[model samples]
Target: PYPQHHQQRQEIFFGNGLTANYQARLRYMIARYAHYDHILAWEVFNEIDLTQAADEQLVSWTEAALDFLAEHDPYQRLRTVSWLRERWPEMLALPNLTLLQVHRYIPHLEHVGPSDSDVIAAMLSDVIHLRHAQRPFIFMEVGHHGHDDSDVPGNHLDRSGVALLQKSWAGFLLGGAGTGMSWWWDSWLEDNDLWRLYAPMQRAFSLIQWDDPGLRPMPVDLGSDMRILGWQSSRQALIWPHSRWSSWHNQLLQPGNNPHLGKRFAVTLQSMSPGRRYSQLAIHMRSGAVVAAHTLHADGHGRLQLKLPPYDGSIVLIITPQP
Candidate 1:
């Protein structure tokens, strides 16, 4: 009754009975489907570590699969595979497997709620712990369980789509290759009409020089229980001040606590050049519109305080050199 049974995995990857047939099938599928522009990448396998195959066979198969893709996939969509977060360090060395991915879930091995800290920390730790990959990393699959497909059966309680957005923002801001890839698109996402949520990420990212090599995570003090995270280059910074004040319990669960909604925030940005004039632009994430524009010069310790506009969910602050 199990979907991805251990014997089936072994057969698919190495048991030799179906290995050649599987490769031929993959080639046929690629030739027919690889030309679609929307198809991002070919994932070699999903959570292959969960299979019964030995480590050596998994690595060998990954290498061979990647080679197979390179030979056949002329369109050359990117390549990735998922592990259950650091289960196979050996797989990271496959140079042709250009992306690293982890499937993160709450209560996997720890007791945690779906609080801001819980969801954010779960993915954030992936970015931090998988730092050695030296390749683009992403949370390839995330939800409340080992399997998140709603078509089957079970309760994955993100009724309001708050967790999805939070994880997306957190994944991107924390140096991931893309937003946290949630697993419930057919159910929660389409059901709630939450496709509009992408506007925030798209607009904010449009204004950021995110590819700059000099960008590194910077410390910030927002003077409250805010999730203050920023990455800075010598001349600019992108800061996200996320409120843990009322989002999870209120917006996601109860859906009535709006007191912390639309509250303005004051922030102290650290790790800047002292006395340098900078122009600040605030991205009101709801509308993806720029608000709270101002200019400020950093103090002696390379800190600058700026009052960001009132926003219910969160706001993005971009600091750049004054012209």
Candidate 2:
């Protein structure tokens, strides 16, 4: 007999009902991966919302998956799912669900046409419903890509995107959404092509991580002397205080700061794994202007507090490996 049937995505088991083959597979996975502690959540599928084939069926499958996890582990595992913002509501109703993950991208201005504030509003509304009612939601993925035209405000878009997302995070703290994730193109920004592009974002989200999740934002006024900027996504966070960089007299064009413009500055370090490598700091300058920048680092760690002042900065703190 079939345990359930949801053929929304190709990942759904072929042939029989949801119970028979799919449930069996689910059990197999849990058993195979004994270290459940490391697993964040059982991501059912990516882009499954776009599949119109078996919407109801998929829901049944999700419910079954949740049941399977609950049966095996008493410590409620987050029944998480990710999809375009349009598909968030369908999964929010599931029992014992942790977060409703929504992926959003701005395809207008830079490229394509039209902005869907309506969609954004609807998504926010759903998040509001979930959070106020004690349910949780997050922007699973939020970022943008370059435009074909010259007027692409890629970094601005990313900065503003997370800023917009923080509005929901504020709501969550006030008992609204749970968490959020800011998406980025690894290659685009890593090469420093998008310095201003994602640096603010990396700094923004880093605050959440640095705060270590317990403390909420406190009210403080630095006036024009300090500027706060950041970037965040579900999996990662980054924050930077622009005042630190801008305070430098003249541009700090030390080596590694800008390889292309000469006097490029580069620092080396290692991380135990990708997860620990949270953020990075580097410097980029243009003639009379100098700025210290920070972004997420996948690997690069192990050292004392960076003494290099005109220090480009490490996105994540470098901790010495224990002997």
Candidate 3:
């Protein structure tokens, strides 16, 4: 409901007796702003399913709008629209939509759980689903609910900030085009002083050369409960692991009783060059610090198994081969 000057409060939805006017407004927006080089993408609408329209109508409306944007936008910025989890299949089918976008929250609407493991497991499942998208995928909204939840204790900061941070890193390493974008940016993040969490993520991602064409998703086997996600090029690999049981909210809510912290485990790397000895294997904290390094050898079948150090939460493993 932005552009309050012209937008009717109740007319945001498509097929709401104002389709013509909405189309005209969209035309005006493209003509006005499509020339801006910094504009990343054009989102047709946010959470269109919330309109409660029939699925057929929504899909038709989405296709038409996507067609208009595709034909008119001079720069052809990435086209995307957000959808509830149930409507994801329809959204993915839109021919002109260049980027896949999904909206998810902790204690999901259908499957609610405040448990740290439950939340991570759910989020990871969603990420796995998005892997089928031909184009890049992104989690458009991720965070704890802005409203008070009777199931969890403490304010949003104590309850959701750490979970937000954890999910962001998880989404990024799990092949998301970008980290999960937190909703309620002003009130939930900045006001609560949780904005500082982005610093470490920024540093960690900066080490990656995203433009390298060889970088592609790679398989990682950390066994059950523990998950490993990674991408590899011929020269290097980036691996990230997460424990299903650890969460910041749990740590804060119960200081002495945190069972998920400080655990050691072996992670196996697959699809490596068989019988090749990698020059360096470095483990990095999410804050972008190198905690450990090793020279490792892959087995005959192109797998390498390494025992990781004991630590709370998640860590990134970077493997590099001699040139």
By TM-score, the best candidate is 3
lDDT of 1 by residue, 1-323 (tens): 22377777575556443367668887897989998999878887888777767778778888888878877898877888777644566787777888788776544223445543345554565667566567777777765453445332212455556666776777777777787787767776787676787887887776767777778765433345777766778678887887655444455446665655667767787767888999988886556778678999999888988777775666788888886
Greater-lDDT candidate between 1 and 2 = 1
Model 3, span 1-323: residue lDDT tens: 44463224433555453377778988999989989988778888888777676777678788888888899887889998887754467768889999887666765333434643355556666766667777898877877653544333333435337766766776677688888887767666666677777876776666666777888875434355676666777556777666645654455544555554677778777777788777543544435577777888888988877657785665677776644
Query: 2 or 3, which is superior by TM-score?
Result: 3
Candidate 1: which stretches are off by over 4 Å? 1-12, 16-18, 33-37, 107-117, 144-158, 217-225, 243-266, 309-313
For candidate 2, lDDT tens digit of each residue in 219-311? 212353332223333233222223322221112112233222222223332222343433333322211122433343343333212212333
Q: Would you list the C-alpha lDDT of every candidate in the order shown?
A: 0.70, 0.42, 0.68
User: What is the alpha-carbon lDDT for the whole of candidate 2?
Assistant: 0.42
Mark the regions of model 2 whose C-alpha exceeds 4 Å error after superposition.
Answer: 1-21, 34-36, 85-90, 108-126, 145-179, 193-323
Q: What does candidate 3 score on TM?
A: 0.81
